[model samples]
Target chain A: MTAESNITWKANFPDSFLWAEWEDEEASVFFHRGSGETLLLNPLGAYLLKTICSEDISEEKLAQRTVRYFDLPVDEELLSAISVSLHTFEQKGLLLSSASQ
Target chain B: MKPLDLKPGEIARLLRSNGLRLQIGPFAVSLRSRLRRVAEQIAFFYGDYPRIEADAFVDFHIQINNPAGLRHWVRPQAIFSFDGFKPFKPLPEDQAFAMFEWGLNWCIATTSHQFLITHAAVVAKNGQAIIFPGEPGAGKSTLCAALVSRGWQLLSDEMALIDPGDLSITPVPRPIGLKNESIAIMKNYGDETLVGPPVTDTIKGTVAHMRPPADSIVHADRDTRPGYIIFPTYSAAADSQLDKVEKTRALVRIAEQSFNYHILGREGFRTVERLVSRCPAFDLRYSQLDSAIAEIDALL
Candidate 1:
């Protein structure tokens, strides 16, 4: 187990976020009412944000869920991509992280 | 009664005296101007618009006049005022009519928070409307002028006023503004009589306005459902093409083009969301007006 895998992540203001998704399109539009900011997210980014909004999850579990949800191979590439998205969401003030117990 | 029903002299008298109150789409504007050019242009371009009574409620009280100083006689300048407050600096006297048109657009776009306003050109056929949202020099007005000439109703050549409640676009059909090469292009493409003489050396380069069709003004009260949202780019080297835009990207693009999206906040987001979800969006690139019109016509 890696140290990064134990970090838990969740939406910063889950109640203030609004999402609009079209089934035919791979992208989604999200609005954060707390900051009044609108952002465009790809399918993977959207799924991670949505999952975090529902409940707090550790990085390892998130990666496992993402792999199962997208039918993606569990490898270093997928883990790296998910890591980048999580950090990006943290930077955008859309998500926050903490050390897990 | 329409402005055309009154003689030119009467129009000028109303403008200089108690002000000429005219019904322009959803708003009533009272215009007071001492300039002969301003009076003449209003009579010429806004002839189809209905004239309101002196005692009626007015949405915008506008005035365009020569500044009171030596500047008035020397270089000569036109000043635009909204409800007696000057919102912009004085411009050259020759640009008074253009200033009036631009000033009215500012009044609507800035104050009318009742609707979500996007910086777009809208034209409709058979009760369905297509919104062309683009920046300056993107040929939106040019395309709008062309479409109107081909019998489409001009909802607006500048702003798309979307009713937040219903998501229907309200028609505020006014004169279609043309700039530079486009002025000549529209002249050759449509009725030459409908196009006004070009005023050179203005802020927007050489500018002219095409008179809105009388039928469009007559049915100004009718708002149409949005059918398509198209972002147009005019590229002389590229072939005319219409490509699908994802709704998510479409919403972001339209929000960027909007004048008061931030002001409306959540309601604005929901309104734009509904609009994008309801309409199919596309990015249209074209140089030839005929082919562009045909592509847009096929969508309707």
Candidate 2:
């Protein structure tokens, strides 16, 4: 799948994820965990994770929200790029396609 | 010979056996009971008119006639139960040693502790402990006990001692409290180290505990940086796995787990805030001990 695909993901985060976090000290990874699939979330991925939980939407909408919150310059190129990233996430089963959800 | 009303000498003897040196209020105690562990250490006392005191650490204290009558006393200030296997068959032992440990925990917690007391099993490695603080049957203690065979050290079997001053978790690798099916469950996962005979009926079916591995008890007082605070639940239908969770949420969850959160009040909020800012938190839903160990080890 490419980034432009318009689908919403459908994976439920567990209760323990309430205070989940990730930080890099000395370039290493550290994050809280729950009793489900361990979803590796870096800064951008974590931001997206929070955004999706806050509000579910299509890839187009997701890109728009990212731009709105993070102040990324909105453009077709950026949207397409984000869509591609989201597609990879769907393939890995980290997030469900909005349509499927 | 009431459990809660301990003679000073009894308290000192326990600390001496465990090699723990402690001073409570004005009572000073030392013990060497660290080498052995039992199923349950309950200190029973009687009195609504006269109260008792001790400088010792214990497991559980029973105020037969609480001096603070009519009050639903929930939390304790100090405690120091061990991970020794003792059975509660036939009849029960004095367990005065266990009583002292629990009493001390109550005293300390009431005096300076202002957090909730959750029935969880916390473990640590490299001075970093994960606070698996949750309610009964949350599978916290069960999962925690299983990890011992996998090399994870036990930080506590019941409460997560959150230090308000530093916001770091104090090490409390007490006995791994097990109840009902858990007692048998531990036998299946690792070499059985039964504590006391099962205390039947009360609640959670037939209940018993397992002595934590030796290393865990020896380092019971050692402080650990709170690294991960997970709320785990055991589901038999599946293998174990770890899920990533967030901060403001962790704050709320910790608030839920506090035994005396309201008592701790503003200081509690500040302490929790510090924890949220520094420690990693998660929501775990797993059934496999091996899988849990591998995933948790990665976090470490």
Model 2 alpha-carbon drift over 4 Å, by segment: A1-101, B1-119
Error of 2 at B196 (Å): 3.2
Model 1 over residues A1-101: C-alpha lDDT tens digits?
Answer: 23277689988979988888888888999888877788899889899999999999898899889999999878888888899999988888889999422
TM-score for candidate 2:
0.53
Q: Candidate 1: which stretches are off by over 4 Å?
A: A1-10, A56-64, A73-80, A96-101, B1-4
Structural similarity to truth (TM-score) of each candidate: 0.92, 0.53
- Tens-digit per-residue lDDT, A25-84, candidate 2: 211111223222234344556666666656566665666677887687777776776766
Q: What is the C-alpha local distance difference test score of candidate 1?
A: 0.92
Every model: Cα RMSD to truth: 2.6, 13.4
Q: What lDDT does candidate 2 reach at residue B173?
A: 53
Candidate 2, B225: how far from true, in Å?
0.8
lDDT, candidate 1, at B195: 94
